[model samples]
Target: MLLRSTKAVFTACTLVAATAFAFAPRTAEACGGCFAPPDPPTVVSGHRMVMSVSQTQTVLWDQIQYAGDPEEFAWVLPVKPGARIEAGTSAFFEVLEAQSAVRIAPAIVDCGGGSSSGCSASFAASDEFGDGSAAPGENGGDPVEVLHQGTVGPYETVTLSTEEPGALNDWLESHGYNVDDSSQPIIDQYVAEGFDFIALRLQPGQGVKQMTPVRVVMEGGSVTLPLRMVGIGTGAQTPIVLYVIGEGRYTTQNFPEALIAGNLLSWDFATSESNYVELRDQALTEDDGRSWITAYAAQNFFNTSVFDANFNSTTLIQFYLNQALANGELSSSCALGLGYFSGTVENPCPPGEPWDSPACGSVEPGALDSRQLGCVGAEDIAVALDGLNVENVWVTRLEANLPRAALSDDLTLEAAAEQVPVNNILTAQIAINPEEACGNGVIPRTIDVSNVPGNRVAALMTTALASIAAALLLRRARARLARR
Candidate 1:
């Protein structure tokens, strides 16, 4: 599908040494439609980033969302020198979201007296996450040394380093960079702290305007995120979503960690909305709005069905064959045959290879080109899987709403004390009564409060709801028997 573009500024910050951050224009929606309550100066709503850390190596993928003149789009990230930038695909985020998004099962309903059997409904898992936009401001500098300059996908990239204060800005301006005036201090701070900067913009004449995601591979496994630079062009209550792939579940080290009280979660039958968001807000508010929630955590939990469908060895071979056909390198589709004493071995199967293997399958007039297998999106899948070390890796999803003032310090990440997994599918314990939903019954009832463990009121409410539901079911069963 084509991404709809608009006219607005993109702003954001990211780090290889310390995690990363991103910002969208005030008019644009923040990362994945996840945002904190609206407040003035909250120009940047939220952003999504993926970080994979194994041993001493780290790989980060940041999706650069931009809505404005393509020429005006620029992005800058801080790294610990020697970081390499590469192209990343949106499929990585899309697949991850589909697998770990918070899902709610429909409430079980019961009618006191009715011809219909008490309702028990279920729904397919679905979510409406959004994307955030961000681009860097420009300027120039004298002592700024351009370390490495090259192209990655459709972006023109340059890595710069400087010890002199304000020299980075001068060099950026001289090179036609459009960094914001307010960002000079942040840039200088990184320089003082010994961090190299990688800047990017659209390659002239690339034709594509919308910016895609980029990957940064660097040494060191520090999980600190540079939030100070995030405040440069963001508003209060900035939302941040991070997906961490590591050896174990990672949580906030310097900041407080918050988890949504599952027992407090309820479904509002009237509005068809869950109290998940409200509970999330309350949890953060209780922590003074400077905490990260371990939204979802698990190990060996990726759903590779999408990747498998589009990028297996069979699909790769088919894609290569299709490309060969289009190039007229192959006359027609080919198949491998094995029999006792074949008349002539004309482009026969490779010797000793299994007949079912792709290696043995050759196309008419020529062999399938191995280089063209990348056209099937196999490379992107490989990048995500390999970079993340998907085998036996622990994946953690973290979220937070940081007020502008709270962005004073960078966020540090560390493995959680307990290595337990947190499920994203939240089943509401409280159920809104249908009568109450229609203004007839009393307050909504808590059907199953077992999640709360020690509440007497919850136990009583659970017993009452259970009795009512049992009576309804008994009546329905009796009516069915009578009819029979």
Candidate 2:
């Protein structure tokens, strides 16, 4: 009786422990040693460099390995002992990686007397693939009966032809398929335009302009096919514009005086990254001795990224963007990345006059509003390139105007004083004050008379508009006077 009682208690205890564990929360898995980023960034030997490059030592794997992450990745200097390190602020080269796997889902199916394997395909194992503009070769592979190679359009549904159409479920179960469920993930992929690799081909140093898109074939199941493409040089300031637009990285960034005078060098996205995917896919094509990837995803990634490179190091650091834009590029592009004249009184002011004047001058504490007057930090971004001939640059100005002045006035005042439609009133600003305003309901304006030197200037007052016009006499005189 004692032994049976002990056994029953042990069984109950085991069940209780299992039940408790089943409901316990799981911990987030720590990601380590899973990915190695793209190229070990280094200063290219032959590239031009204008900024005084710096590097800091970061020991990894117990001093067995050491690397330097630059404040910015451009023409960067490698890490050497006793070398100055670049200060890191934002981002660095990161590698996108994934573990390839096969998955299937199970369901009820009536496989009606079909051949083994349930499904069939016209199979072709070829040395050639990724025919961007090329047709499939007639002699590539032996045709096999295949179930699916295309989308299930309405007209092509299996409902009309097959009596036992649930063979997809049967095939999936037999193959132990695990479909990546959740329609949201697939839809999100399309909306985000996210890809493991973006294939692009471009001329050397062309950058974003040449970044063409390459697509992957996603059937019912996950298939990581090899992709390859080429991109062209966009030469835009932010090469990664389209990829990061909704994320608020959109801006006109400028890099002024980043190059040295005399050498004319241009920047380009390096291609070493794509070489990886090309080798991994080991893809073949219809073309004899051709690999499947013209450029593989692993290989194509290299073309999608931006690298600050020197086209000509000795050229004047002050190079202009190919086409001048109305506004400047990124703020840091001029002040930080290129290392222009910053850290002045315009930046974060350190307890001084002018910049640190009155608190009521701005809406935010310790920040300058656009309306305030002082040595502006933004002025530094306006690079006055000496050699460029920028003709007829329109400088925009904003001004506030209210015709009646008083909200109580029942006045229908329409004012557009800037551009004169009539020949006489180009600069004429019509100010209509109610009869009661000149004295009764008027508030006196506090005009600073400090520049008038003790307010000694004499005032010659004209009471009537017709009298003022008569003093000018001719229409041309009135028109000329209207200018002032």
Candidate 3:
């Protein structure tokens, strides 16, 4: 049993999170869970979540970030009844985030009359919460009902339900959870909406240093994130990064959708700043701080280089071998190519023996037994691939910085009207010439605002004026030559 009590308010830290999804149903297995927080009072440093959706079920993997005393940590989620809890690993998010993050291609610079290395440069950047369980109060007079209690991964988890206004908080307090009075209204709101609350705490002797991630599985339930709960104990601007995998591209239905206008951005050779942030902030600001940018959207979106490199046969076998060695089940003399899928192998076993043999080579890579790779939590990869049908499914990544005011309403998602895909690699359209880099860098030679919406007329007018100015300079030169 675990228990703690402190005055600190409960904070559910999710990056661009708190929503529900529906997708194909599958057995809950291990996956990437919450992120590891380095310090207490975990601030709004953005969040990441993955949702696989289908008609009948939705599996969401969220990272929980909490920096505080291990025993004092408490995470509460307003999930639909019957939702199942499961353990997740950090590698799942690590791989997906690396594969999907935005990358900026280096600027194509033409340094006439000289060669300078600083002209062209490329840029790229890769950039959750709770579970716990406790002994249920035995007093028959308690109003809160303990629906389910069990251990999932490193945390002990418990699901509770009650209709009374303050019964749930009272129960949480009795269990040694430091529930603050400010959260009562939101807790009441969720309770009034017929939502069940789940509280997770680290199991006995478990500490915050270990990043334990968890997921909530909902069946046949169409739900949106509870943004109200996410706003508690957060700063004014909370960045939410959401990834949705489904049959087709998805977009936020309630909040306005914005796209980073790549054409308007430029790479500054002098400063090495891509100016991408300026355009992104400008677009979001135009939407009153309640917009989500569709950073990447496409079908069959996995990066073969990143995914295959991590999930290939060689790495899986190595991981299995490491596990075997640590468990003292196999001798260090065992070679890499040979592995036993199940049953303990004796140290210095006879080679090529019928009863004691290495069988890893005979099994196909895709068909390799997942049980053998349990030490690395590779099952979460299979769960994602199978549940989302990765090869044929659409993956969408949305980003937003929601001011506290915008978090009042839950965000809803729907299939995008246009299924066109957006590329994550942004190539700079504007080029720079190092010879004149300090003074706008030959922008007139390449800058074309003609294709830009609502700017065609201005582009043409500017072109005409430049042509007229050139002709005037030519006439003056001719007059001076005649006088000489």
Candidate 4:
């Protein structure tokens, strides 16, 4: 039940889509807290945030900027014990988004027996780090315990723990972080729950422009996200995209899941894309301003080639095992052996040796090496994890739009194993039209109408007939009276 959480920040809003698709499956839980008032505010417009959570790990990526001074850019994150921090490449996210992005294809509606008016169709398509060093700090007897201090990419990182909340704020302020009164309450909450803090700041002479994507790996039972901390800066609402890759789909444990009305899907005639903007917006709105929407879910088999150019059985086993370790599905010790067998083996890969090395190869003679037993040169790790069945591997994506009020709460994921099927891939994309228009070229026309002029003619004829009848009745009455 060890849970890990990752936080990422980026520079522009355009990267939201790409960052959203970069996720791994793991279990997650929620923690309560608020962020200190940033001097210039951390949250801003045109910023994108993405998070991924499974049973054992959680990953978060977001965009950040230095609003005040280059030296003022800093971030504080809450994490469980055994957290590992490192820089990540942007290519990983870009590739995932491209592979998993929702593809919008124009649909053709033929109005049979039509002259020129019938159908409409269209088509469409589409981090930071800092040096490796830590400032000298006092140790021992301090309310806060500094576990690790080092440079990751362009940011200086410090992992610390303390039972006293006030000491945490002081430690952060002493370490050159902008910790205001607002941060204390949040710090207290985490402290009460025995959570550790990871404080990050730009290295000397390093600006936010030099910031890169950072990954945080922690050990815990459930995924925990400190969204309230994200609200410390200025902003009306923040858009959050999360992808959960696991055995099955995941849903929100704390918030309601946004219900998507796929039935309302319509084609946008102007843009040649599905007019899903309304539907997406409506789903986000109906959730009462804060909710998680399961946008996409399915099992995906990734080709081992994606990880290694010279793919082989040894490489394939190593790749899947490494992913499993990163996601907390497999332990480091087990990963070294591809987590295939639990018993002792002779001539195992030496400590620090590559997993694909012959030393790590199976000792069974004439039998296909571990790589052969595990199919190599395949698109996915199915052969390596044949025991789990490749068909059952799946990834789920969730999305949310949060206002400042909603940021006070934490986000957690809950999923059941039975919800997923083996050997199936389910992918979904929200179809929002850049231009709102229903694509069908046909405009509705009124077929039945009664004109005012026609009504006037009928009224005149009825009046004339009534006048003639009245005159005849008067004549008949007068003639009868004379005869009498």
lDDT of each: 0.51, 0.15, 0.51, 0.43
Q: Give one digit per residue, the lDDT tens place, for model 1 in 1-484.
A: 0011112111123721111233221112222111111221122222457876654446677764433233334567777777777766554554455445555543433433321111333322223234311122232333667777778767788887779998877767666665567778877887787778787766667544335667777654556666776665555566666787765788877789877787766665655556676677677765678877887787754322221222222222233233233323234643222111111112223432323457755434433222222232223333333323333566787877767677777777777888887766556666654443434453333345354444343223332332333233334433544575
Error of 2 at 349 (Å): 19
**Model 4, residue 432: C-alpha shift (Å):** 14
Ranked by lDDT, top first:
1, 3, 4, 2
Model 4 alpha-carbon drift over 4 Å, by segment: 1-69, 111-121, 125-137, 208-210, 271-274, 301-391, 416-484
The best candidate by TM-score is 3
Off by over 4 Å in 3: 1-46, 66-71, 112-120, 126-139, 221-223, 302-376, 385-388, 431-484
| lDDT tens digits, residue span 53-106, model 3 | 654455677665433454445567666677767776554554444445555433
List model 2 lDDT by residue over 60-103, tens digit each.
00000113331211100111112111111101100000000000
Best of the two (1, 2) by lDDT: 1
* lDDT measured at residue 278 in model 3 versus the true structure, 0 to 100: 66
**lDDT for each residue of candidate 4 in 1-484, tens digit (9 for 90 to 100):** 2122223211111111101111111111112222323444443223323444433334455443223344356666676666666554332333233233333333223333222111333323210010032334656567778888888667777888788858888877776665556657756776776667777767777654424555554432344455655454424555565544444456776788776564455444444545444555567765567876665555533332222222223232344343333323333323333434322112233432334666664544422233432221211222112222233444555656666678777666666434642211111122334222323443332111133433332233332332332233334433544575
Candidate that beats the other on TM-score, 2 or 3, i.e. the better one:
3
Give the residue spans of candidate 2 off by over 4 A: 1-184, 188-339, 343-484
User: By TM-score, how accurate is candidate 4?
Assistant: 0.59
